[model samples]
Target: WNYQFLTQLGYPSNYYAAGEMTVSQHLEVSGQPDPYNPGWVGLDYIFGSGMRGGSSGGPHIANLGEIVDSATDPGQFPDRNTIFAVTSWGYGLGNSSGTEIKIQGASPLSGVANANNFVDLFNAACRRSRAHFGTWTCDLLVP
Candidate 1:
């Protein structure tokens, strides 16, 4: 988890204040609705993390590794550093006194079966960028 300020009661402080956690659960496209907060939806992946505040929009990347621009082999899945989701919300298992177990969540960036996918969104942004700049700026990264 990435945050600017560490507000959790028992959480420690460090430079950059960033940490990574393994995702435990992945909710489906249907998502979970909160009864406590009306019209609020929770369609995200759950993981164990101590990050509390100022980390809402951090990226949740999958297959993260070194950028291998190999001379022999281009390597498998060029988009290995792709961000699958972004941090949404989290909570701790305790009361106002203190927290015991910390858990975090992030909503997926794209679902394979979804009508409006990440590719569409990315393309739209690229188109808009080209329209304004008279050149395809995104082509350098994607193409």
Candidate 2:
């Protein structure tokens, strides 16, 4: 799974403040015949706003956190039917110090048959959030 903030021109945004932060977490399954197995491998990654910006750069871009399950049923082979679940959040410069901005999502299997499926889901979420905030453009680069 992936998370991104697109600029008004469909690029990325650069917005940051002191003590501001963003994070992402997720689970994924890899190297498995059946992508729905519960024994799949898991992974997690975290990104936070530092003295400057996050790891991506000032005005953090995309922060990607995901879990991968590489364990297969042993008898099954690899296929494009892999399933993945992911969640992410973003932080922008706020008026108050220590204030935070975040976004998150969870799905049983996401039911995404392919990469495009996942992309569509995430893009929709971003657009929705942007509309609520009244922000036209933003930058998104996963770290």
Candidate 3:
């Protein structure tokens, strides 16, 4: 799904790099539910090279790069934020590559009074299932 849904739920999207500049990267989201918290859903993708080392995990450990918000309140949504960690493999690295996206909040999801409300909104949107690529996800995060 696109970040628009996340923004609709009041979440910000952050980006990061995984390894060297040569490695290609992207984001993926599935309607997977969080096994640890059924009340919460999950979106997972490989971050950087799952291979480890050789510029693995990129230059930053916690890359909270940017934030995008809706133009309007959009009604009944909590203020949530998403942080992404990305990694890549150099040319000819073979199958030595992977990438990941991590969605966290500036504050704990449970701490936000509107947390459940936003989750409900996200679930409603997920029924339609929208996926995007490149930096386009950034636009989706804002209105």
Using Cα atoms with residue i matched to residue i, what is each candidate's TM-score against the true structure?
0.49, 0.22, 0.21
Q: Give me the displacement of residue 132 in model 3, in angstroms.
A: 32
Question: Which lDDT value does model 3 have at 5?
Answer: 28
The numbered model that scores best in lDDT is: 1
lDDT for 94 in candidate 1 is 67
Model 2 Cα lDDT, one tens digit per residue, 6-120: 1110112333443334342223222333223476532322223222223233122222234365766533323322223322333454456667543222232333344346556
Root-mean-square deviation per candidate: 9.1, 15.8, 15.4
Q: How do these models rank on TM-score, best leading?
A: 1, 2, 3
* Model 2 residue 40 distance off true place after TM-score fit, in angstroms: 14
**Model 3 alpha-carbon drift over 4 Å, by segment:** 1-19, 43-143
Q: For residues 22-83, could you state the per-residue lDDT of candidate 3 as single tens digits?
A: 32233333344544587776443322222333343332122133446565654453433443
- Please report the TM-score between candidate 2 and the true structure: 0.22
CA RMSD (A), model 3: 15.4
